[model samples]
Target: MEEKAKSFEELKPMLRPTGVEPGIMKVDPEKCTSCGLCIQNCPFKCLEMDEDEHPKMKSGCVCISCSNCIVACPVDALSIERVYTVKGGFFDTETPAVKMPMPPKDADGTPAEWNEVERVVLERRSVRHYKKKPVPEPLLTRVLEAGRFAPSGGNHQPWKFTVVTDPEFIAELEATLHGFWSGVYPVFNNDETVMNMVGVVETGVFDPRTQYGIRCIALKELPVYLGAPVIVYMGAHTKLNNPALTIGICGQNMNIVANSLGLGACWTNFGAVPLNAMPELKQRLGFGEEWTVVTALVLGYPKFKQFGMVARHYRPVTWFRPGTKTPQTEK
Candidate 1:
């Protein structure tokens, strides 16, 4: 087997981080076109043309890992690398050296502080398998209201929402998704969970006692989008630089609001891609052609209380500390 050499130019595009930064750039000499395309498309203007008219680091620290330049490059020629060994591990791809913007401030324009909100974030969990009951219209409205309040870039507010309340619509949507996924099982057989599902689906032998999991656990077991009786579909204008981010913020807002209201919510993206491909479904959902589905949520009341808080294990607190292995005393 040939060991793959780093085609930094070709592979660099994939390394650009969607967010988070002040990272590294790895370039491949062999695949570099020197067309300066990377420099042209960079959102932060962090890339520049060298004497050879090839893309090179400009300020180096202006990158935010948006990956725009990497994706825009005609020939993949850039990869983000971390200057420090410790910072590289957090990013899925190399991010250009740049700082993430600070979170927004509160209504009084003071830098936002949300101790309660932070607490809610820690408490949130994915809840599936809800008891059969219709979600009330008022509660669904509140969840959507919270989502609409989410901030957007330049306050574009370019989002549309479709709340699937009718059981028939939900059933139809789920059935369509089920068929599509069932067809694609062969291609994804390498995935163990998917492979097992493929085996079951292929058998075509119906066994009522055998529990066949649906696309999303929330979609399968719950009566109303997992028991809250509502599902919210969030769509965004893809022309924006960060549609996904915008939609995600909105989704979180809805989730938090739902939690506060004593409702449970689970986020899912399984429907977005395929749902967009079907024009009829998109139109029925009232989303426009310029709009792309960002995310969806299954919402309902919890059948049982969440398991209480446990120790939060994460990458490491040492990275944020002054030095490695600094002994901690709870402040």
Candidate 2:
């Protein structure tokens, strides 16, 4: 048997921070024919070749270990080794990169046409006001297909979308949602514990009790889905791994697809809140045994023209650095 070369760990360098450590990318010389795809796709420009044409990291170079080079390597010559203080690991094919179409590009290599999917995502908004118009059956089916195609944990594909368009049913949904808020309003009024937990952001002008009261009263005046002709009830089994998240993921895909089809859509947790007290709703909404409602989508034409970009902020992000020691306590 041919003996293998000693690995990076054989160098025994002092490891980086406790929780986050450096990930080294290794290339097998025999497997690589120096095609140079890895060199082209390296985002950090960490990979280079020697006189023998074997890809290696430049002297004193550090890899952020994003694994772009590994994913772009057609021959699988590049391997990423995530080094931890106690252990090292690799990612599955799913974790490496996703397969998707190339975006339309300009002559200058800048994206020429803003991608339709990208535009839909950036422009999507939670449309509260909708015209009393129905979504066509064909369009609705396309949106459901988007949900059906969403990725799931372990390929369980555990998502069922029940679409309700009947006026009487929407009325019942409105009543149940109102009842939930009405019931909660009293609790917030009476229970200090519940009040503290509510922590309702005084978003515009009302206190927690006031907001709940306002919502309950508004629900009584408005039909469910705000007169939108479609209500999509997203349901999933509770036994699967983080099933609620799969339902949410399906819903996100559905909503974006809806927007692309010229339909306005928004998801609501309040729609499912009533199910806690109204078990009969489970049967009416087609939530079978072992299935629970996760979220809901209301779809229709926008009542008012929505144009212009809205300012938004993202949550804080921390980038881990290589060769730096960061002390963090395990929870």
- Displacement of residue 247 (Cα, Å) in model 1 is 0.7
- Encode model 1's per-residue lDDT on 203-308: one tens digit a residue: 2211111112221222333122333356788898878767888888888889998888877777755555567778888888988788897778987766554412
List of clashing residue pairs for candidate 2? none
lDDT of 1 at 12: 31
> In model 1, where do residues sit more than 4 Å from their true spots?
1-116, 190-228, 311-313, 317-331
Worst 10 residues of 1 by lDDT: 204-213
Best lDDT among the predictions, by candidate number: 2
For all predicted structures, in order, the TM-scores are 0.53, 0.57
Q: Rate the local accuracy (lDDT) of all candidates.
A: 0.59, 0.63
